[model samples]
Target chain A: MSARLACFLPLLASLAVAGERLHCVVIEVPSASLPLLREEMKRAAAPVADHGPVLLSTDGLPRRVTHRGQAPFVPEKPIPLGNGPREGSPAGARSFNIVAASGAGGGLVYDVSIQQSPVPASYYDFRTKGLVAAVPANRWQELAAWNQGTRSVSLWHHLQTDEPRAAAGDELRIELIFASMPDDALAHVPEYPPELTRQVVGHLSGTGRVWKSFSLACRADVPFHLQSSHGDRRRRQEPGYGDRVLAKFQGRITRDTPGHATLDGLLEAPRHHEGDAEAYPVSSEASIGEWRLIVLRDGPTFKAAAAAFHEIYTRRAHVAAKVNVVAIRVSVADEGEP
Target chain B: MRCPFLSRTSRWIGSALALTLAAAPARDRLHFVTISRGYDDLLREEMKRMAGTPVLPRSGKLLTGITGFPRNAGYQGTIRLDRDFPLEWSVQRSGTPGRTAGDFGFTLGVMRAGDGPGLRFDVDALESGTEHDFYRMTAESVPLPLGRNTWHPVAAWGSEYNQGMSLWCYREATAVAASTATGIHLLDVQVGFLPEPVVAAMNTFTPEHTRLARGAMAPWQTLSVSCQVDRPFSISSAAGERAMRGRSDDRGLCRLTGTLTQNYETSFNLKCQWQPPGGKKQPQVRFDVPLQPGRWHLQPVEGGPRLRATGPKGEVRVANVAAFRITAAEP
Candidate 1:
C-alpha cells in the first residue's frame, strides 16, 4: 500500500458506516465573527456553542453604521442560490422551509431543511426572514455524516454579511457552526491540534483602484501562510468585467515576530479595450497592485501589527474603482489537520 | 490417503499460479500529470515588480500533488487505470485570462479506449477557495484498454490554445523492465494558467469586425491581430493563413505572440509585415495555430445560422468556424 493510503487507513477505520447514528453539532456566526469564535475555541480547546451579536443584518448588509442614522438597506432578493463563482460547495438552486422558530440568545432561532415538510432540527439566526447559512445534502458527505439521520442531531445557524450585487467583495462565507458527533457516530469527524491553528481577522477597503490595508494581532506559533479561504470573494459583474485587471488581497504573518500581523491589498483598473470577441475574453490595459502584511509579538499578548499597500496604475485606463472589504477573517490550520 | 507424488504436484502448480499473478500487467503503475505555462509565477512576479522593485519572496503554498491524495511538487497521481476505474485529477486554477477566480476551473478530456481525436467536453479556470479544489475536476469514465497500448496526444476540445498557460494534455507509456508483456503509461495532463502573465505577454488589438470604404465586404470580417513577447510564436491571419515572427531579448525570450479575431466566415492573408531585429528576412514557419478556449462551434457556419455546443456538464457555448484549413499565402 502507498504511504498515503497507509496513513489514512486509521482515519478510514474511524468513519461511521451508513447504518450508524452520529451526534452532529452545528454552529452559525456572522461571516465576520467566525475568526473571533475560532480564536475563542482555539484558546479553550473545546467546541463553542453560542457566540454573541450578529455583526451584519439578516439582509447581508453590515449592521454597524458608517454614520449615525444611516438607513438600513433591505435587499429585494437574497443572493442567487445557483452555482457561485467559487468552486466546491453544492451547486444548483435549492430552497429550504423554516419548520420551526424560537427565541435564542443570538436572536430568533429557526429550524430549516431542504425538505418541504418540517424535520426535527434547530438552527440559530438573528432574524426570522432570509435563509442565512445551510449545508445541503451534498455537503453532508464532507462532514462524514449521513444526511438522513443528521436532521435530529444537527443544528442550523445563519451567517450575516453585507455584500451587494455587482460589487467586488467577499460574498459567500459558509461556516460550519459546529459538528460534534459521539465517538460511535456514523461518520468520522477530523480534528486538529490546538497549537497549529490560528484565526487572523481584519478589515480592508479602498477607492478608485487604490487598495488599503489593516492590521490584526498574530499569535501563531508557525509562519503565517495563505489559506484557501483567504482568497474567496464574490464574482464581480460589470462592463469590461472580462478584462483581466481586478483587485486581490494577501496576508503576511510569521511566528518569528509572534504578536503582530497585517493584511494588504492590490487593486487594478481597466484603462482601454485592446481587442474584441462576441463572447470571449477581450484584452485591456491595467497595472499591477501588490501589498504585504507582517506582525510582531510582544510579551503574552499580541500588541503590534503593520500593513503596507502599493499599486501600479497606468495613465491610459485611469478609471475609478471601489473595493469594499467586509470583515476579513482567515482561519489558518495545519495542512495535515484536514 | 493421498500419495506423496500427487501432493507434490499440487504444490508445484499453486506456486506457479502465484508467480504468474505477481507478474501480471495489472500491477503496473499508471501515472497522470499536467503541464501548463507557469502563468501564476509570471503574474505574481510582474505584480511585485510593477508595485515596486523586485524582491523575491518565499513561494506560498506549492501544490501538494493533485489536491487530495498526497502533497507533491507537480499535479500527479498513480493508480491502475484499468482497475482503479475512474481516476480523478484535482487542479488548482488560480485565476488567469479568460478564466476568473471562483469560476469552475475544470477540464474534461474524453477519449475512446484506444486513441484518436477525443472530445474536450469542458474547460474552466477561475480563482477559488482551497476547499473547492477537492471537487474541481470531474473524472470521466474510460473504457478498458483494447489491443493497442501506446502514448499519444488525444485531440480533445481546446487542445489548440496551448500558447502561454492554456491546457495542453498528453500521455506517454514506458515498458516495465525486461517485461514486454507489461507496460505503464504516464499521462501528463496540463490543465489551467494564471492571469497575470497572460496579461503581460498577450494583447489583442481593436475591432474584430470592420469594412472597407467601399461597402460590407466579407461574411466573416478580420478584426485585428495581437502579438506578445513570451508565447504563441505565431498567429493566424485572414483566410486561415499563418504569420510567424521571432524576436528575443538578452535572455533568449524570443516568442512571437499573435491573435486573430473572426466575426463570421472571412478570408485573409498571412504576411510577415515586420522584420526581426537587424532587419533580417526569416523563413515562414508552418504550424497549427493553437486556439484559446472560446465559443468554437462543432458545426459549419454554412450549415445553419444556429450553432450550439454543450460542455460535459451542459454549459452552453455558441460559436462559428468548425475547423481551420491553413494554406500558403498568395503573393
Candidate 2:
C-alpha cells in the first residue's frame, strides 16, 4: 500500500464505525520510570487483588524461551491492533487489561481498585479513599495528562466500557473524547501530541480493532575485553540489539460475536539473557544476549480479567533485567449512545 | 509429420522467449542495515573476560573477498541461499542511547547461488567509523536505506566511549536490469543538547539568553539553524537552510543528491538556498553551526521545529537536531 494511504486507513476505519465507537489514549513513559509505575499499580491492585478483577501486568509472561537453533528470530512488526473476543463471552460486557506482552511489565493503568471487566461504580469514587473522585465523563480530557510522579489514580488513556450495569444497579460510563483534528491531521498526532489538545486520536468499535503504539528507548555503553591466545582485545561496547523492543505496547479492544467490548493490550519487553558463558569462557559475551518476553493474551482479552492481580508478583522476577520494554495500550471507551 | 519450416520457426520463437525471460531485470528494493555497539558495562566485563582466557571466534566462515573485522564484529552475511532477496535488512546496535567505541560498515549482497550472476559491491571499510566536522558531515548525503537505521552521536571532545558512526551500502545486480535495485533515502538533521553533566548552561532558555547577552551573537547551541532543499516542498520555520536535492531513480527510489562545501573560514557560517525542482523558490532555511573545537551543544526549538519537504518521489525532514550519525548509501 502507498505510505500516505496506509497512514489514513486507521482514520478511515474509525470514521466507518456506526453504532459503537472505541476510544483509546497512548502515553509515552520514559522507560526509566516503568518500575516505579508498576510498583504504584501493584499497590492499587492490592485492595481488589483477591475479591475482584484486577489489571494484568507483565508478571504473566514466560520467564525464558531459548532459541533452539541459530536462525534469527525476526519478529513481525506487530499489527497496530486484533481479532474479536472469544465466544460465550457476551460482547461489550467485558474488558481485559494485559500489560508488557514480552513479560517486561507495565500498562497504562488508572486504579487497581477498578475491575477489568464490568468495573464497579464504587471503584470510580476515589473520594472514599480521600482522593479526588473520578472526573465526570465530559472532563475526561483533563485526566489525559501523563504524570510519572503521581502516586494515585490518574487517567492513563481514555477508554470506554460497554459492560452491563452491576447487579447493584449502577452504570459504568466512559466517554470518547475526539482529538481536535481533521482526518488529514490524524497521522501526525502521535509524533506531536503535545502540539494538540488531545491524545485520544480516533475511535474504534468493540469489533473494530484500533491501536496506538509508542516507543521508549534507553541505552548506556559498557566496556568489555576479550582474551585471545595472541593478545587481549579490549573495547568498550554497547549492546548491538536493534529497535526490536526498547519496549512495544499495542492496546487493543475486540468484541466477541456478542459485541462486548474489552480493554486489553500486548507489551513486548527485552528479556536480558546472560550470554553463553561456556562458549565464550573468557568474554562477558554471555551477559549480553537479550531475548524478548511477550505478555500476550492468546484467546480472549477478558479471560485473565480477575486472575491478573495475583500473578503480578510471580512475574516480577522475570523482569528484573534492565532491558527494553515498549508498551502499546489499545483501550476502549463508550461513546454514550450514538 | 510436421512441416520442417513450421517446426524451425516454432523452435526459434521458443529460444527468443527463453532469452527474454533470462535477461529480464529484477528490481530488489534497497534499504540500509548498520552494525554498531555501545561501550556499556556488560561489554566492559566481556572485554575483561576475554583478556583472561583464549576465546575462539564464534562467527561463521568469512567470505574470501570481503575485508574488515566482519567475523569478529559478529556480521554473519547471507547464511543460506536466499532465492528471493527480501529488501528489509536488519540493523545492529546503531542508535544506542549512549557511549560506544566506534563502528564501520560493509555492503553484503547475495544472489541465487548458481541461478543468477555474481553480485558487485563497493565496500568502504577503512573510513567506516571515521568522524568528521559536524557541519561538514551533515551537508553531505549519507546514503542509508529506508526503514529503521541507527543514530549514534557523541560529543566531539567526549571520550572514545561516546563516539558514533553513520554508514551506507551500495549493491549492484549484474543480472537484474532494473534500477529499482538502487535504493531509497531520507534526510534526518537533528540538533539537540548533549544532555547535562556533559555540558552546562545550554538549556531550553539558552537561546533567549544569547539574544540578551550578545545582542545578536548566536551561540551554536542556541542559533536557529535554517535548512532548505532542492525539491517541491513545504517547510516549517524551524528547518535551518540546508540544501537537500532528491530525484527518482530508474527504480522509483528517491535518490538524494548534492553536497555542501566551503573554504575553512566560510565553513563555520552554514547557509543554503534552493530553487526547487519546479523552478519555484520557496523560503530558504539556513543552519549556522559554530565551528569552535570541542563539543557543540544543540537544543530543540520551541513549538517543535520541523522542515518537511516533498521530493519528486518521497518526503524528507530536516527537523530538530537529535544525537545521531546518518550514513546514506545505495545498497
**Residue range B222-272, candidate 1, lDDT tens digits:** 111111112122211111101111221112111122323322233222222
Q: What is the overall TM-score of model 1 with all chains considered together?
A: 0.18
TM-score of 2: 0.21
Segments of candidate 1 deviating more than 4 angstroms: A1-338, B1-14, B22-331
Q: For this target, which candidate reaches the highest lDDT against the unseen true structure?
A: 2
> lDDT per prediction?
0.23, 0.23
DockQ for candidate 2:
0.01
Give the per-residue lDDT digits (tens) of candidate 2, residues B250-292: 1111111232332352222223222121122233233433322
Model 2, span A60-94: residue lDDT tens: 11111110011111122111111222223332332
- Quality of candidate 2's docking, in CAPRI categories? incorrect
